[model samples]
Target: MWVDLVVEEILREAPSHRHVVNDAKTPSGHIHVGALRGVLLHDCVTRGLRDAGADVEYIYGFDDYDPMDDLPVYLPRDYERYLGVPFCNVPAPEGGGESYARYYAQEFIDVFTRLGATPGVYWTSDLYRSGRFNEAIRIALDRAQEIREIDREIRGSRGLEGRYPLHVICQQCGRIGTTAVVAWDGREVEYECRPDLVRWAQGCGHRGRTAPFDGHAKLPYRVEWAAKWFVLGVTVEGAGKDHFTRGGTHDVASAFCTRIFGARVPHPIPYEFFLYGGKKMSSSRAVGAFARDLAEAMRPELLRFLMVRPHPRKQIDFDPAGDTIPRLYDEYDRAAEAAQGEAEDRDLARTFYFSRVAGDPPRGFRPRFSKVAFLIQMPTVDARRVLERDKGAPYTAEDERELEQRISDARRWLERFALPPARFTLQAELPEAARALTDAQRQFLRRLAEIVQAEAWEGEPLHTRIHELKEEMGLTPREAFGAIYLIVLGKDSGPQAGWFLATLDREFVMRRLREASAAPASAGE
Candidate 1:
């Protein structure tokens, strides 16, 4: 169920329909699974409100205007140029990617886009430059005495040293100042580059210097939060499970909005982490899968289903196999199918799975076939061989040309994203269905391999010849179909065996089959 805190806060504190959900960065590395989880939950919460007939504008903000830390010597050499600059001022990555924050933000949006979400974007730098974020800053400044007390309390709680900076960086002018002072002074911040300090690993030369608590120096991280919440009037936003803890930042932000901004936070939902391949997807240890990689491995639509179909609060341990991907979609398809029949609670389930209404919904909220399913269906191939093979697969020159295009697209996606594991496992004790391949089935594998190699691994003629084999063997289409799965998956059940094998080249399949057949009862460790 959606948490009521944000809604309650909004009713009493914000009172207006406009509010925003702020996802700020803390000088951490790029976004990871945590960001993805947050966006998904936010998407679901906002989507739920829309379903329930609420008109809420969800705005998302990126806090890119913070400073670098004392650990600059540890960063890439380029850190010298950007270390002391407000994070947003740091230039975007070259070659058409994003700045660190923007990169992660866009990654979050990519997931949202696939799931059909459309939250507006407002960079902190942009907001500050436009002079729209200072009112909240003033309120925070009025409570300067209180903020000092809060800082002291925080220091005591954390067992810190003498004092810490009360203000945050202004992405606009790139100055560090308190939100409280900025509201009253009405002075635009002035930025100065500290390249020498940037050169030193110890500290920015100004590190321990007693810089004044100018309002410009300290940004009301919370005030900015309030301004965003007030301006965009977001109805709902979801955050990590960690943020909802008692007395966490959310608690403080909630109070700041009510006491300072005279507004409420939106409906805030909390969500758990998703574990991929038996481990929680993480980017810190540099371990975990990314969305682009997942998309490349399969299809973007399947990844969307995996993300959006689940309830916001539940945890997901995503496994590429084990029927997890298809199972989720199957449930979706089931809910959709039952929505047509008069099944009990079918509409509710369908609403949860797909959209509430059956007809075409908004583009941001539509469904598609999963890339994972496509990956499972596509023939396994040695991607390098597909790329480098001088001789083409057995096919008419025209068909070969078409197949090359598909292979090239697939390879590009794979290169950018999915990681092909080092080992392939073939079951030692084959399933009953697989154990039943007839003599004709064996001949067909050989014939198909020959056709494939001769055609230079092209697609169409390979497809056409499979049907011919089916007829020549005097076997039902179903029986003839079983052979491909038996040989490739070592199981009787799988996606279409013919298309699956066709997707892969002979070398990849041959190696995988050999590995599978040669294994002991167990596979890779």
Candidate 2:
């Protein structure tokens, strides 16, 4: 909602050109799902800008020119030798089809595209190689001292402190981290490739400075942050909360923009990220959910909905290991229905509107997520037929497609993230857990077997019948359900027992219950 407020303010200011919003990330490893937050935030902002009558374009960049700072465990130990090389120049993993940068960058791009955030993708290496960044390099060198002062003033650094804003790839080893610009002669830079400059890679100790042009050298991150705005003329962008802190990269870059480059800095929309299992997601650490993981587990619109429903400032601690998927689907469904009706909360309804995959979302005959997930796992049950009966009508084409997609999503979620409580397999015979039931529980099962043979089966009515039998047989609801689970699911609990049993073949349900009701007799013999 605040994004709307920001876009409205920017609309009033009215940039002279198509409003440019940009986001960039270094493909240091497999891109984490947390990175999607920025992609979604910018999409929402760009849409808001367009709705507010501003011409807008969104560009996403992979900073492949950045040096590899850390290697993930999946890479070979020999990859350490390339640690300080530009990411685009490094080799991709064995069997990966492209350069290291393209491998991971393309994967992440596919993810963003599927999530409905269609951003113009630019690899920084391409910009440099194509000479697009040449002018920005010149600007950085000409304003080197001013840029250094802004950094020093903002970060409270003493002097230059052995830091130069420019890094030249070593002429001998082609490693960027081994060299630092020692002096500039107004044209060529003087530098040394020291062996001990960084821990990841050793330099050849060669000392020579060529013209830092045409992909030869790059500005350090903070300066480049400012350089890109001047080069691309970005008008609206958002950064995570990390960059908006006092004297952080955004502040320093804003200062550089005002004083050195004479360009309007990108408007700031500060947002937080999705945390994974209570910690920050880092691809290099391989500790958080990857974009690929989410792609496999969620439908595209549902994945987009996860990011859209939360306010930009709130932290989402997602545990993919839990029931967050089904719960999210339930919440998303409620929001979709509210959006369809005359509504009280317009912002929430607007969120549901934009959260769709594309075009109109499915309408009519939507099944509950939990129920769909439950029925898909049962081999003997035709879930579609059951769902149709439950709906009291056949599903429309769109509803059938939605049901199939939900089945795929539920299967993926079960395979990857289902906890013990969410899992159950139908028994081949009565389980030993059923043999331990008391005589009254066994009698309830025998009576339930008769009901299974006689009652017209459906979720609600059978559920009511179970309750009635619970009262008639003087059994607690838990006790009554426990017998069904132990006999059919081999546990003391499972999916809502009546609906679960209703989904199975009538003969199978009757036979399983009858076998369970007799388990104690065989045990005594």
Candidate 3:
């Protein structure tokens, strides 16, 4: 629904009906999962435009020509020598022929493609080398004074009087980060690579003059952003809120676009950050989960759901080490159910509709994720048989596929990210913690053993019986459930005890309960 609203705004305000929705990222290291937020945001807007019968193109650019200012900690310390060099000129970490930029860029590209977003990909290095930006570079050089004035007006910084807005690669050292264009003649620019230019990389003090075109030089970020819009004909683009703040990069770029380039500014969409553990993620700092790892850890549709369900203005805080994965699966399943029914909430239905990777949302028996997780850990239990029983019917092909995917997802979570309560291992012998149970807890377990032995019960009925016994014994829920979990899982909490026990061997459950109740109490108890 929010996507529809954004589409309406774009249609009303854009200079033209045919639109290009664009986003770009600099691949300095393993691209973090947070970058996917911008990719998917632009994607949703593109999809919405197409659905509304508007012609739209989605293009994603990799800023590969940008210099590597920060050496990622994951790389070798020797890589510090390459810090001032352009990413396109540095060697890949794995020593292949590919540039450092493309090596990491491809990893992130694969992730978004798996999420069903296939945008036309471009590289900044290619744009520069192929003369695509030659005219824009010339225009920027001729209007250097005007560009400086615009920056001063918007940002209140007036020290720049003769400095041009371009950086050339040093002719001697081949580093772009430390080179500054001091003066631009009609065709060539004088530049210097100063030793103390930046803290991250030391320059070689090289000086030269060259024509600042055809890949010889690059505009500063704010100018380059505007040039990309002019050359690419982008009509809609969104960035993080930091750039859209008062007197921020967006403000300066907008002025440069209109005054210097004589082009209409693209419609702006300012979005919030995607944080990990309450901190914004970084691509170069290795601050959050990498996009490739998250893609591998989750099903493609579920990952899409994680990005698409939240509004662009809302921040997402993800922590994989706790209940986050299980809860996300639960929310996705609910949306799927809602999408299939006409009477469900309309917003929920829209979320499910947009979250889909391809085709209609499958209609069939859907199982709860937690139960599937618990069932897979029980070595004696057939997860398929148990899920099929819960379905109360034979498995359809669609149901089987869905169950298999959930099984895979659950295993990944359990293996990598599950918290203690969500993880389970059936104790082969009476656990030591069970020996510390009070007399009342032992009495509750002894009665529960009799209930399990009396008859074979389904999950709901067995769950009901456990609650009744807890009430009858006058024990707190913790006492009643803790006793069961300690004997079976050697933990204080777990999946629904009734369904958990139903999946295990009847004899095993009966024996464990009996042993737990009869075990000698610890000396202190």
Point to the candidate with the largest lDDT. 3
Candidate that would win on TM-score: 3
Residue lDDT tens for model 2, 387-406: 88778887888779889988
CA RMSD for every model? 11.6, 2.5, 2.1
lDDT of each: 0.49, 0.83, 0.88
TM-score of each: 0.57, 0.92, 0.96
* Residue 179 error, candidate 3, Å: 1.6
User: Model 3, which residues run further than 4 Å from truth?
Assistant: 519-525
Question: 1-525 in candidate 1: lDDT tens per residue?
Answer: 232333454456545444444444342344444455565555555554455445655566667655544332224666554444555555555433556556555765665565555667667766666656655555555565555455345333331122221344433334342111222233332232222322332222132222223323435454455556665554455666777776665665566566556676766666777777667644423556665555445444335446655666778777654444445555654554555553566444444444332234222211222323244234344442433332344345444443443444344444443333211234334444543455566565666555555654444566677788778767776566666666555545554444456566567665444433332342343
Candidate 3 weakest lDDT stretch, 10 residues: 155-164
Q: What are the per-residue Cα lDDT tens digits for candidate 3 across 1-525?
A: 788889999998863579999999998989999999899889988999998898899999999889999988899998988988999999999786498999999999999999889899999988998999999999998888998898899988763565788889899988998887898779799999989877888899988999988899888889999999999999999999999988899999999899999898998888888887787888878788999999999998888899889888998988877778889988988888788884477787788888877767767677988888888998898889988987989999999889989999999999999988888888888887776898999999999999999856678788989999999999999999999998888999988888888878888999888887885855887
Please list the residue runs of candidate 1 whose C-alpha ends up more than 4 Å from where it truly belongs after superposition.
1-30, 68-77, 80-84, 95-100, 107-111, 150-202, 207-227, 230-235, 278-285, 298-301, 321-323, 339-348, 351-525
Instruction: Give the C-alpha lDDT of model 2.
Output: 0.83
